[model samples]
Target: MLLAIDCGNTNTVFSIWDGTRFLATWRTSTEHQRTADQYYVWLSTLMEFLGIKAEITDVIVSSTVPRVVFNLRVLADRYFNTRAMVVGKPDCELPVDVRVDLGTNVGPDRLVNTVAGFDLYGGDLIVVDFGTATTFDVVAADGAYEGGVIAPGVNLSLEALHQAAAALPHVDITKPQRVVGTNTVACMQSGIFWGYVGLVREICARIKAERDRPMRIISTGGLAPLFQQAEDLFDDWREDLTMHGLTVIHRYNTHKDFRQ
Candidate 1:
């Protein structure tokens, strides 16, 4: 079985893959202080409830928060007795070529997303990831990782509104019935939701115009579905796209004849 861990800035997800398919997945808030015992306890209890049992023989990890990777590494080594494959390291062996300036390090999550997006769509693609920061990455038709844009995430915007403004309260994002809001909550929702729709559409349009190619737009992350409902900017949404990428990279590295 393969234990795949994707550690983001806000959340860390763990899943077990039993060679053929994913057995189960669980998510929790990312904490740098979490120990090997803490991970083992939480995962064992959760997997026991779901009736998925396995001896974790292999492990793979992709992390946006570099600080938490230490705990993840310790957990993998101590509990599973395996050294996890850490993405973004020089020897990680990604399937895509990243075209970036020297000394600039691309985020592991972005690279994983590009690899998965290129594998599925054959490049000329745009991947919008809605995490702590909204990232837009462009993959060329030939699987080159061209850089893209970054926007403030929806949740961050809400929090900023509450913190900076005196009267505004931090509210959940939702699609409002109309563009014009009748109340404070409605106004906040409309601004956040509709504003993102416009932002996504405009950025995609500009990217397409600049590249002059028919690039497929792929949206992922927690807030993707919510924004997708209000706009047709994205061609597809895969909730487990990052997980699929991790699995693919793991297989490629572990198996000599992975293609077969």
Candidate 2:
């Protein structure tokens, strides 16, 4: 079995893959200060709940948070007894040709999303990830990571609204029944929900114009389903795109003809 870990800014997702199928998956809050032993205990409990054995053969990690990466590396080595193949490392080989600045460290999650999107939808694709930050990754016609925009995520925006304003209250993200709201909660919802939709459409349109081709828009991350419900911005939705990409990369690294 392969253990795939995606450590993001807000949440960390863990999945156990038994070669061709994902055996189990779980999510936890991103705690950078957590020790390896603590992580091991929590993970073991999760695995027990899911009935997954602790005999994982390989581990793959993609982390956006540097602090969490250090702890995850420690956890994998100490608990799993395996040195994880961390994405964005010099030794790892990604399928896409990254055309960005040489020293720029693109988030592994974004790279994985791009690879999965391009592989599934060919070139000229935009992957919109709505996580800690709303990331727009543009894959060129030749399957190269050309880079894109990054905006404050829905949750982050809500947090900021509460923090910056003295009276505004933090509210859960949901589509407003009407665009024009009559109450405080509805007003906030309308602004956030419709504002995000407009942002998605405009950014996607701009990216498509720059590419000058028919591009497939793919959306993932926690807020994808909610936002997607209100608009037709995304051409497709893959909830576990990053996990699948990690599995793909794991296979590619272990076997030379993995793509075949």
Candidate 3:
């Protein structure tokens, strides 16, 4: 079985993938302070509960937080006896060309999304990921990763508003019943929800205008379904897009036939 770990700013997801299918998946908070031993204990306990005893022969990781990579590497080596293929490292092989400025450190998660997007749907495309920061990544028709936009995520924006203002409290983001909110909570919800809809549409429009071609938009992340329902912008929403991409990259790297 292959272990695929995707570490985001807020959370880290671990999944076991057999050659043909995903067996079990787990999610945990991404903490840089944790040690390899600690990770092993937690993972083993989870496996015990689930009755999963598959041996992990290979591992692939896509981490947004670089600090967490060290711990993840330690976990792979100490417990699994494998050196994980950490994306964004010089040694990690990618399936797509990244067309960006020199010395630009593109996040591994974004690149993985691009690779998966290209593999699933070929063409001029934009991936809107609702992560810690809502990112817009452009994938060219030939699968080259073009530069893109990054804007404040809804939760970040809401937190900033609440932190800066004494009267405002941190809001639980949800789908608003109406755009014209009457209560303070309702008003905040409207702004956070509908506001993102407008932001996504405007950026997508600009990208389409600049590219001057038909565009396909894909949405991913935990909050994708929430916003995707508010607007008709996203062509597809795959919650496990990152896992799909990681699996592809792993096969490409480990299998000589795939690499060729």
Better of 1 and 3 by TM-score: 3
Candidate 1 lands at a TM-score of: 0.96
Worst 10 residues of 3 by lDDT: 251-260
- Model 2: per-residue lDDT, tens digit, 9-114? 9999999898888888889999899988988898898878877775787889999987777888888788778888999997778887898887898989999888
lDDT of 2 at 247: 88
Pitting candidate 2 against candidate 3, the one with the higher TM-score is 3
- Give the C-alpha lDDT of model 3: 0.90
Model 1 ranges off by over 4 Å: 256-260
| Pairs that collide, model 1 | none
What would you estimate as the lDDT of candidate 1? Answer: 0.88
- How far residue 218's Cα lies from its native spot in candidate 3, in Å, is 0.5
- lDDT to native, each model: 0.88, 0.88, 0.90
